[model samples]
Target chain A: MDVVKTPQQAAVTVEPPPGEPVPAIELVKIAKTFSSRRGIVTAVDAIDLVIGEGEFFSLLGPSGCGKTTTLRMIGGFEEPTEGQILLYGDDVVGVPPNHRDVNMVFQSYALFPHMSVFENVAFGLRRKAVSKAETKARVGDMLDLVQLDGKSDRRPRELSGGQQQRVALARALVNRPRALLLDEPLAALDLKLRQAMQLELKRIQREVGITFVFVTHDQNEALTMSDRLVVMNAGRIEQLGSPREVYEHPRTRFVAGFIGTSNLITGRVRAMDGSTALLEAAADECLVVPEAASAGAGVGRDLDVTVRPEKIVISEDRPGSGRCAIRGRVAEVVYLGTSTQYAVATAGGTELSVFVQNASDADDIAGRGADVWLSWRPDHSLALVTTQPAPAESRSDLSGGNQ
Target chain B: MSRSRLGARLTPYLLVLPGWLWLVVFFVVPTFVMLSVSTQTGDIVSGFQQTFHWRTYVDGWNQYHTQFIRSIVYGLITTLLCLVIAYPVAYWIAFRGGAHKSSLLFLILLPFFVSFVIRTQSWNFILSDNGMLLSALKNWGLVSQDFHILATAPAVIGGLTYNFLPFMVLPIYVGLERLDPALLEAAADLYGSKTATFRKVVLPLSMPGVFAGVLLTFVPAAADYVNAAILGGARTTMIGNVIQTEYFTNLDYPKASALSFILMAALLLGVFAYARVLGTEDVLDVAAR
Candidate 1:
């Protein structure tokens, strides 16, 4: 280990077991730039990634953040301006999509309108000149996998959007390629249908035992469905980790704000005690953070940290010295069916958001203008490594202060 | 209230009255008069009367059967030639024209700004034996002096094809435009080569346009006499020229009307057979998709 802890590189790597087989997909410094009339737009910057076999990998970010572009490059729908793409350890550069060993389910579902579901699924088998009986059996099996066996004879236009999506999936998966690329396949469906399909997709991926690379802008979708996901911003990877690791320990400011709601606070280290640092938020108040979080920095160095709302407890009295605590007046309260959300303004003029579960007829603990104490474990206040300006949304709820 | 309800019921009729009146005056009365005249018997000087003679159809068919066959053959050849020449143009404009699509389409249709007769007449200058192009080809030994294009079936067919190229291209362009490019990408992603992708997806989806173009151009091209009159000699006279001559120079109204009715019926039967063969239902379904 080096003297300096580089969380950016460590958090972004999801190491497979030792002596793992060849990766299903490997991107080596891939980049794509499109020249438009306005100017050249860098849709995807040079980035390296390796997706393990049988893993549900995701590239997630907001729209135009290069997730879809990266997926397109993997599917061979796009050619990288620079870098190599390896499929099962073979460089796939210059190979047309038809010759590639991967299939893509497009955002529009791209099902052949004139073809029946059966024919669409059988298309790849037919291209490979599979026997008629085998094509029929394989198409039947694929349709069954998608839960659309009886409807195989129907044309794509006659089916609903969700059915069309299944047909698109079946059409691609029927080929049994090394990997499957899905570009926002669930974005067109209604919310409930999308959720159902997410689980259904996971189940199908498990049953097929093929590598699945899913690209989506929906953070919750990625978090719930992906074994590991790469959070991207502005054509670059912000962080990559398993969903829990990313949600709990985001290494960058963008990842912290993008994955879920969090309160960001800027503070300066006041004292270092063994493995924890005390920050002087005010004359008599101190904010405690992991000493490892500010490891490379000396005292008086400014740092930004994030604490998830669910980790903070709201009560009437301040916590003991062992825990970090702050006093705030509840600015607003929203009753969110299972949890009550509080927006509190501290004496330091920092706004903090807190989420409390409604356990056994729980009601609003404190109304607007009522004073409340917010406390959490010292380690919960994760110090973000990247010095990027706190995202605009997090700045509105600065939480690490006790002035 | 009842009166107003009646007035509301009459609104649709009132809105359509002008169009109905125009059709009645221009189409219905002329058709009935022609039907009556088709069965009359007369000479130009001796005048004519309604004899209800039905043999006129048989007589007209027997006399100009060769010309009728020639007209159908010419029209079929022109339609096929137009399709061959227009399909690629339409595909290019629809798929690759990009920012210049509208301009390219305008260029395809630019000849329509000139009169139909003027456009057909312009071909006369191009195809004439001593014309600039043909004469130059002759002087360059590209053709024998006797190998002239003027007053031939190819000249008339070429003229009709030029006159109707846009009819073929526009419909195909509209059809190809309606096709989702994703469908093509999907075909390729499914391991279809360029040729296979075109044969399976592009050709099938563009059938509706081809069908429409065939009808729009064939119907008029078959019934047209202008190209034959200007660009053809006596050997190349079509049924349309026969009909025109019978009605105009020969002053034979009954024969002309009978021939006109025969041509109309033949075209209707031919198009009906075409529709049956191509299956408009399949084309319409593909279009809908």
Candidate 2:
């Protein structure tokens, strides 16, 4: 019920299932550790996640962030080092992939090259001891659903990459699995095809009304397709929320910078209001940020602030109408068709980037080396908790006196 | 064009030409000569004339017809049996053997290092009346002491199977080695059980290996007479024994030559038939790769 009706829609309204709890998939404090020559690398930290039935969920992160590891654990290909994976209230931690009611479309689209398209799609049904007539009919319907009806006789190698991708989808979906796991399914396609497949995948998930756990490193792909995304970093979850909720209200500096481009301003808290904080930046500039009402932090404490580029406006003179203003020198101005990017240097000798849209040919106001005043609405700047460094000495050693 | 580029292309051929020429002169020429001599009939003292009778082939067939046909039958049975036994072992060694594979494969090939004749002769000691195998069978009450296994049809067939087992294993191992493990995993993910996965995916993908192993076991088994000479008496006198008898005992070179060429022709037809079914280039080149 939380599914988006249109591909272009950005809003998601979740409606709970009818009465009973939808025990879709629950991982109870899952931990996975791998031993290698390097050391015991914790591929997945002890974390819990509950993916509801019929939810299009995504595990989004950068490469080597353990997002894929989480997906694999749920697919029954891997067992957690400590915890249990429950699908529909049954423990599936030790279950084999074939025994689980889940199927994964591999990153390589690992379609069986030996079988015809029809056989590949009908594989699971036959495993369940479906009659020959029923298997044939179901396979035919699945091929038709994937827009590959008549091409069932063709071998996997005979199909193009996109068609092969569709065949893989059909092969995994034909069994009516309780959940479909996609591991970078569209990462193998070119840009145009990836975009097209993203929409097609979302549409297919909608039509089938099945829980789809999609894994990807591409932020845009996650944002465009997921009903909810769990952003992972270094084997831990950085944030988990709806795409718009996470994008607009990132609780951490990592989440803010990762979901899109943003500037991190480290500072010490100078003063605090009920829902706002005034801070003195590391570069000696003062920044005012709106704080979350729940985080009750006292004054003179270290904090981090996040400001999106598009939210900040650059003008030659002080815009007296704005809530907050900072003086800076325009370092560079690069025009990209619809918008312009200005890299500016603040009076405190810190560089800041600002993105200004060309709403009506306002290019003359923004130019290279022009002194300007940057301002943003008071509510736009976010005051987040400054993640603790290992130690000041560790930071100094890592920097090697570069500062 | 460029000297290095041309040299690169020619280097492979230059390195390969000596071997190619060796095969053509030693193997190709001898096969043609045998084919020619197969169609002739004469006594050794008279020397083989170019009679081109071709009826000598028919006469050779009539003289050793039962044995000649039985060899083919034994070859087919051995090949089928080898395929059934070797396929799973080869698949396990290739896909599931993991890091211990190299050592296991070496062990399989270790028996061949001692020489085929030695291995075939050793079967006699194992299958003889007073041998450990027959004695153990007697102790176990599986067979009577008067029931002789040596110098029988099954003994010759069993010896052939043992002699050429590595040949059957190596080709199948090669085929299975080239198989991609991901393909099987994909089949399993698509809901195939262990058996269905092997039947639908693993078998078809490894056909090149199966064909190679079959050809390897069949051709040599059909041409060999050593097993019959050692373990089989007059009961299992195959074509090779018939040829040996004609050439040495009866002093009939023309008849022996005719029999040799007929056996060679039968082998060629068998290979061609195998190629037609499994694809010639696929089996050979896959194993080679």
Q: Pick the candidate with the highest TM-score.
A: 1
DockQ of each candidate relative to the true complex: 0.70, 0.51
lDDT of 1: 0.86
Candidate 2 lDDT, B1-289, residue by residue in tens:
8999999989999999999999999999987887777666666776777778878778888988897898898888778777777877887889889899999899988987887778777888988998989999998999986988898888988888877787878877887787776677777776567888888877776777777688889998887888889999987888888899888999876678888877888889878886887776644553443
Query: What's the iRMSD of model 1?
Result: 1.0
Please, what are the lDDT tens digits per residue for candidate 1 over residues A102-132?
A: 8889889887777888888988888878889
DockQ measured for candidate 1: 0.70
**lDDT per residue (tens digit) for residues B22-116 in model 1:** 99999999999999999999898988999999999999999999999999999999999999999999999999999999999999989999999
What digit string (tens of lDDT, one per residue) describes model 2 on residues A287-329? Answer: 6777644444558776666778899988777677435677889
In terms of TM-score, how similar is model 1 to the real structure?
A: 0.91
Positional deviation of B26 in candidate 1, in angstroms? Answer: 3.3
Report the number of the highest-DockQ candidate. 1
Regions of candidate 2 where Cα sits further than 4 Å from its true position: A1-23, A35-40, A131-137, A281-285, A292-298, A317-337, A340-353, A358-360, A364-374, A386-403, B1-20, B40-46, B126-149, B177-179, B244-251, B274-289
